[model samples]
Target chain A: MVAIADSVPKPVARFRFILDRRNVLGSIMIAPAILYVLLLVGVPFLMAVYYSLSAYTIYDPSWSFVGLANFEDVVQDPVFQQTLYNTFIFTFGSQMLGLILGKFGALVLLRPFPGRKFVRALVILPWAVPIALATVAWQWMFDSLYSVINWTLIALGVVTRSQAPNWLGTPHLAMLSVIVVNAWRFFPFAIVIFLAGITAVPQDVLDAATVDGAGFWRRNYQIIMPMILPIVAIGLVFGIVFTFTDLSIVFLMTMGGPVGATSVLGFAGFQTGIVSGDVSHGAAISLFMLPVLFIVVVAMLRFIRRREV
Target chain B: MGSGGNKNNRSVTRRSFLKASGAIGGAAGLAPVLSAPFVSRAVADNKSLSIVQWSHFVPAYDTWFDKFAKDWGDKNKIAVTVDHVPVQDVPARAAAEVSAQSGHDLFGFNGSGGAHLYRKFFINLADLVKETEKKFGQVTTIGKQLGYNADDGSWSAFPDFYINFPGMYQKSLWDGIGMKPDTWDNLRIGGAKLKAKGKPVGISLGHSNDPSTTWRGLLWSYGGAIQDAAGKKVVLDSKEAIEAAKFVAALYKEAMTPEVLSWNDSSNNQYLASGVASYIVNPISAYRTIQQSNKKLADDIFVIEPPKGPAKQIMGAASEFYGIWKFAKNKEAALEFLKYYRDHWPEAFKASEGYNNPCFANLVPKPMPILANDPTSTPPTKMAILQDSDKWSAIPGYPGPATPATDEIYYAFILNDMMTKTATGQSSAEDSVKMATQRCEAIFRKWARRT
Candidate 1:
């Protein structure tokens, strides 16, 4: 016969017992992250919405309600409309260029070439570098006076010194230049996504396609691409969100210059709200991005859900 | 046998140790949390002052300023913190501070200061301005226009220094071309000739302070005004403005490269210093920068008054001023520091190498020491032309106080864009004027309602 104390089971500590509940433990683990998002992101987002509907400004920190007046003003302004159009063009143009570059990059990196690891690291440098730092470097490269590209073109005798293009000055070229920098910045991330999606396509499927006499291009286009469509679409969605809301590239490179030719929503919002101290209109300009962003996110997510095999 | 028994009694388990340590840590942390308020209050009341201003365009000025501030703090028995933000980021940083209702005690503004924009957030510096005036004659006209609020008859901020916008020209380049950019017609004709030879005059047309100031000078010299003298009306749609816009367009086509459309405040400096630009309208900082880096290039650079327009020769000046925040913790200390800084204005002027002109009439009296006797300048009298810069200098809301609406228009880059659009062939001069007028009216109406 065992003693009474030895026969009974040991009591767990109260804290441990509480933590043993899955719900309690899960909530405790995620509490900080949830709190951070709520306080930093959610609160500011709600404040922005409130500001959009009010006559708030840095000078006059009042919250007197103004209804849709700010939005109405923004809509009527031709510059805001131009900015909206530019944002779309910048987003889609850069996305297409980035995706194409990324796809080709993935194909090239898929092979087991010598020094593959070094090459891969070099390829990721653009995305790995901070955006502002990279953009500043690009700004110098596209500089009106000191652009290396123009210097090279002139040295090659392809263009005369007088004919060297003002990369950030001409309206069309300014837009193109910003798009190229942004695409270059983004292609590395796109390549990573492409590689992951492409790698996920099994050897079995490729072997089957090969046995069925599918050439390399046919195999990639018909068999593997269909399976990786969901991932690629998801990547494109992220690219859209990022490129659409970007401020650094446009701000540092062109400053929406040559007369608002390259102005995007983000930079415009900054110019109006922060620089000009007109918080209400700035908030309104920023909120204009939400509907489009929401639609793209939701549509892409739905597509991803349906296409996932 | 007795030592082993004692060791066994003294040994502690991990859990028991942790429990004891946790109690000790809790008490240690609780002491600070409990006393933080009282300690902060004590520090705020009499011990610390903070200052935030732009990183000066001239690096040496910032070096001198930081040391001066530190020495002052040491003498005063206060812990002083000075933060230098980039010029472009100043407005946004100030907005953030105002929004949070907390930040540095002394806020410095470059170029017109925008005291009118955030007047409510700043304490009225009338007494301080009056006291300074007693010591050093009356503040200059443009200084009053920049800092004084006519509505309440208060000086919302204290004018510190004014940066005169003179034409910085590559003397060798202009000499080779046999032209002097003393008048608008001469700049156009001579600039066209120079551009044909692959060297162009570079006045910024970008959305930067340089362009903003340059265009206003042009507008004013052409007899155009953004607002009437009373600062109560938008007069940007005048025939003179249309002519000014057209003149810029012709200048862009005939005399300037598209590069001017992309220049920032520093670009013109870089262009002229690189020995490429024939002429640019800017402060003396550009020449000073060359003086530091390349003495030979500095020798070739010369200063002249802004080009003469048909109507007048007025040019816009960049103004620097300081304001004490109403919510500042150590207001008295901040005021004291300003007073100290004010008393030593001549030293500040020397540190800036005469780039900063005193706003007070008598602080650095006639023949202005630095401008009169400069070792670095090519002739050692190259900068003496700036002695009468105040005569040609006009604030942004010219002929009137720079009001909140004018401040808004300035920050929004309305005038800059109007000139840019017309120059770039994006819009007709008339259309650009119309668009700018509409924008100005909208801003004016918004700000007018508050007044």
Candidate 2:
């Protein structure tokens, strides 16, 4: 009876066996995701590239190939040049502040303590809340005339009526204020990532370091930092991307002002391309950030993969 | 065994049929998705006109506008939907519409400049303008400049109204300083004294419509025009322009606090109503807001003529326009509605609490009942200045035509930045003017070359 059963044909089973190969199965599983990216991301990016090269406005469907004219306009214009500098300042400033604040927060929370969960919850508020709501609230807090901070300072006799600082008025102060607000909103995310990385550090290794008379600073600087380097690198990459392309905070707070002092490339692009009716020029301005971002992401990805290996 | 084998075969065939049916249904789903536009077009062909506008600062204005449109729709057997969004978001929303190439049939912008910005997307309304003007007198000088393109003689929009920007000041504060702020110098003098008394002047230096209005008034008074009368060349680098820049900077330093640097359109209203500032250059809406929020403060609020400069006293206002998009399914109905509304301007103007100043001079009658007596205003004549705003008021690119280029400069807050940069001491007045001139030139060149 067993030999007779084995002689039966199974055409469906043979076809299934071919599809079940690892490479074929993997590709089939990811087909939907790949198609989604192609339709949404790839096509739009290509359209943007085309728009940047050609004379195109939203109203017109036709385009005459203007070559590098938009890019030329962008490069020669002093406003776009300032925007590039501004993007660098905002991204670098906010990311550095976020990393430092996040590490400090994670280290403190890493320790066993009371209300630790509650403290962590409060720390997560900025990350949990919506960006627009949080940034608008910050705008009120940093008002030029009625700043709550200045009111507090005046109450404490720290400053007089005329001596109070204008947080978002002066150019440098406006840039600083935006960076601080941005860092405040983003550091919670970094802290969460760093906390997980810190927990992954081996307990035996820390105990061994303590046994060797390693002090607190030595343990963190020499031992823990190197151990979390890969994770730190990932966090830095995320912070850089987020800060570089950030739109809401700068737009809401200073509107890239006190004389376009706070206008990053993203906000400038929106103004030029969409609001001011210079779409191709806007695309060109935005594309300037791509190569630098790509290189940074690729380098970080390789570093991540090497560590994993 | 035969019966069991038959049952298994039937189940397999049934499962395969279900699988094929599911696949076919999924593929068919894409058909509707692809043909959605055509179907919508068919459905909307007979649909009533739709309008999108800024929610008026005065709640009553919206109530009046919405009801008026609905009534007109009822008479014409059309369904009218008026969607009022916040004024600040009007530009972004317009941009979104331009990008999608689909939106409200009749979109209303807070300022006339928006029509110029997206001129290509609008229907040519030259004939409609001529018809409306014949019914109502010649549309005011501003009405033509705001709604029509000079080069092609095409009307891109129909000018609906203009909101006035007058001097809104605290009566007691001004009396104490013994200054009426009748001149630009008087504002600076009074504002400085008031600042020392702990209540500074409130005028925005940020990217806001109010700032653009205020600065333009100053620039125009100083004989500084953004462009020549033809709107062809950049002329912001004049000696008068630099003088205006310096004067504004001195005012900022001596009188206003840094708060003005961050003020949005509503911030000054809030500041004045909060009693933190002695004076704010704004529309009468600020005083009205105070009337609702604080009656005591509202009583003290008095609006006078806009401070004068050596050149002239120009009210920096952009006429609000209602434009019909070329892609509109109901352009014929939209044009009909617009003509009817303008024909019935008297009722609309009175209903808007004088918030909607008429574009046609024929609409303003002698003894202008609304301005002479207002139940909401402290003094009956407090709002009278608004009735005559058309006399002194001119849009941003005054002396020159309000072209797309001028509108772009206003929308971009170009003048606001120049004033702010100088005020904050980031750039010298001369240097700021030079930079602004360069920017204005580039913008002019872009639009000039395009046309």
Which pairs of residues clash in candidate 1, taking residues 3 or more apart in a chain or in different chains?
none
User: Candidate 2: which pairs clash?
Assistant: none
For B1-451, candidate 1 gives per-residue lDDT tens digits of 2322333565776789999999999999898889997788565546888999999877889999999998999888788889999888988898889988999999998656378778898999999999999999999988898789877889889998888999987788788878899998899999999988877899999878889898999999999999999888999999999999999999989999888888778899999888888888999888888888889988988899999998999899888899899999989999999999999989999899888888888989878887987876779899898888988998888977887678778877889999988887888999999999998998888776555
Q: State TM-scores per candidate.
A: 0.93, 0.90
* lDDT of model 1 at position B261: 81
- Find the candidate with the highest lDDT and give its number: 1
**Model 2 off-target regions past 4 Å?**
A1-19, A58-62, A305-309, B1-46, B74-77, B364-366
TM-score of chain B of 2: 0.87
Could you say which candidate leads in TM-score?
A: 1
The residue ranges of model 1 lying beyond 4 angstroms of the native Cα positions read: A1-14, A17-20, B1-46, B111-113, B172-178
Q: Candidate 2, TM-score vs. the true structure?
A: 0.90
Could you give candidate 2's per-residue lDDT for residues B1-451 as a string of tens digits? 3323444355556678999999999889887888888887565545688999988877888898899999888776688999999776787788888778789999888765567767889999889888876776788877877878887899888888888889888989899877887888998989999999988889999877899998999998998988888767888899999999999999998998877776777889889988988888887778877888899999998988898999898878756899998888889888888888887788877877776777876766756767878877777778876777888888866777676577767766789999988998889999999988898888777666555
Each model's iRMS: 6.1, 4.9
- Model 2 native-contact share: 0.39
